[model samples]
Target: MRTVRYEVLPAKGTEDKVIAHVPRDVVVTVTASPVKGLEPTLDLATRLAAHGYRVVPHVPARLLRDDVHLKDVVDRLRGAGVADVFVPAGDADPPAGAYGGALPVLRRLSELGSPFDHVGITGYPESHPLIHDDLTVQAMWDKRAHATYIVSNMCFDPRLLGDWVGRIRRRDVTLPVHVGVAGPVQRAKLLSMAAKIGVGESARFLTTHTSWFLRFAAPGGYSPERLLTRSAEALTAPSSGVAGLHLFTFNQIAETERWRCALLDRMTG
Candidate 1:
């Protein structure tokens, strides 16, 4: 069976809806902050685990004030029966305290001797607006030992992803990759999300330096079929170093789940 991982933003009143509809066995990871804070992350993970899903919550290092905060997070996750987590240097400006980046928090987690089975780190197939490509790769190298896998951020090109996989393998970064793709999202929904999530800067840097806003605003919109098919191929290939699918559901749960089921049928049929 193909695994589809869903990304959930830490929004008010969203936990119930997401947990109600999301499949039980698929991996569910919570965003550290769709807006900001640790409360939502812990809350969402607790709900997901209650619903019988293996939940992974994002721990934004910058948000943790100190070792005490880090330990509290670990303890909370452990209490929720969470065995997996995703650590990233978040978009938090002027980081909270000692932990400004993922490296520091990952080191802290290791020192705490937490028993999480899987830890994930972000990968950029598309370039980040402010960060250079070399630094991103180096971050991956720095965090590989702590992470069980790499979750590539949204990229519209599969060839780019394939090339990235090859590059990662060559670099001796053997951590499995969860190829990230936007799910069957409506055009309007994507634009709405883009607006809230700094779509302008995101598109300018990641989406070919072209006007993604203009593209989304046009009559004909976008579909991720090309990228998904290519990713499926890449994942199926031997030595590709790919693991499974990570769907950026954008909270359009039903459509994304349907898309996942249809793809599974096609692949198995």
Candidate 2:
């Protein structure tokens, strides 16, 4: 079985839920909220690390004020013993600082001698809502040197995910990819959040693709088994270089853990 990383929002009540339901074995990645800012994210990460869980905190570039702010954030995480961080060009309108994207922040991190052991950069399997497809691909190529691995944006189609891996490899961006998939979540909320943002571009693909509703919104809700099973072949292929799974929990910590355990039982059974 591949490693699993559970992504949680640094929202109110989330810390308690994670400490309760998410096992220490699974890596927990705390997300940076544009509305709440990075303070909550780092705070949650520090607390989670204190709880003995390996945590990866999102350090969105647009959230920082400048290089000094970036240093402070890095120092804070290092002090808290956070070894991994996921850097994305944040969606903060009127960015909080000099960084408008992740590249500048990533460069600064390297210049600071990169305190974290692992750093992840975003990958788009489908067309970005704003960035051109060619540019998105080229952006991955550009970031290959700075990031340690790639965690792809949420993608429902197995074919698209496989094709994206192929495309990136062809472009010589060979970082292992951690396939991003949504955990068990309420269909209604998932669709609504899909129109906005979460850990990935799930909103654009799920909302814009009308036909997905019937398939994803089964009587229960969106379940990741079908997608993950279908993705196994591509993921395990020698050339694919898939590192593991990154589940966008959407703060459904308990349900996500239950579903993951059940699925693993089925696979083992």
Candidate 3:
């Protein structure tokens, strides 16, 4: 329960916020925006690595132009002392180049001698908005060989998460799964972000997952501890292979940190 990782955005002021509010001990993962590509993510990751944090930057397959691009990225990250990476078949509509998904990119990384000691692949605990549940599971089976672990996308339903974990075990996917949860988000902040992103996206986000929406819209807003405590049995069960937490901070670094510490304090006492 003490172990956790904070996933940050590749946006302006993100670096400053992390440096200010987050400590050096926490494992930090940078997310790649489908629209913004991977440059900002890489830049922030490099800066964070230089600042003495164990940085894991997302290398979305759809963003890479080719093997040449992949090599360049590997070289850059290596130079920055990065030893971990998260590869996802990004949400980009028209992929940047030859690579369309994470498999080819993962294979290419192996061809490049696997620069990263830790390579993370995505696991959908709940059904993905676009991809079918069956395809997501199959994707994990295909990606298992290349990845060192799995980081699930945002999932609000703990019971659903538990069921997904059981299914993975039954399928013989033994990789350690890091459960994804949003950290200490405020309702007003959520609405503000929704407004900023525009109604089209907000509506899509709000409507896609009913459980997620209810939790978000519920009284007093979202609280990670609610999910964590409810999901404890699943997380610690034998053969669950639940590694730790992958918190979606959404740049709420200070609040997330405080929430984490508070949760830990409660656990201890």
Kindly give the number of clashing pairs for every candidate.
Answer: 0, 1, 0
Worst 10 residues of 3 by lDDT: 194-203
Residues 1-269, candidate 3: write the lDDT tens digits: 46689988777898888888888888999987666778888999999999999999989898899889999999999999999999988766689999989999998888888889999998887676777888888999998888999998776778898999999889888999989876777866655654443221223455676766876887965668888888989989978998899987767888888888887898899
Report every candidate's CA lDDT. 0.75, 0.84, 0.83
Candidate 3, clashing residue pairs? none
CA error at residue 259 for candidate 1, angstroms: 1.7
Which pairs of residues have clashing backbones in candidate 2?
Answer: 194-203
Model 1 residue 10 distance off true place after TM-score fit, in angstroms: 2.5
What is the TM-score of each predicted model, taking all chains together?
0.90, 0.93, 0.92
Candidate numbers, best lDDT first, in rank order: 2, 3, 1
Per-residue alpha-carbon lDDT of model 2 for 35-89, expressed as tens digits? 7889999999999999999999999998999988988999898998899999999
- The whole-model C-alpha lDDT of candidate 1 against the native structure comes to 0.75
Question: Which candidate has the top score in lDDT?
Answer: 2
RMSD from true fold, candidate 1: 2.6
125-189, model 1: which lDDT tens digit per residue?
A: 77777788778888899998778898888776677877777777877888988887777788777
Could you tell me how far off, in angstroms, the CA of residue 44 lies in candidate 3 after the best superposition? 0.6
How should the candidates be ordered by TM-score, best one leading? 2, 3, 1
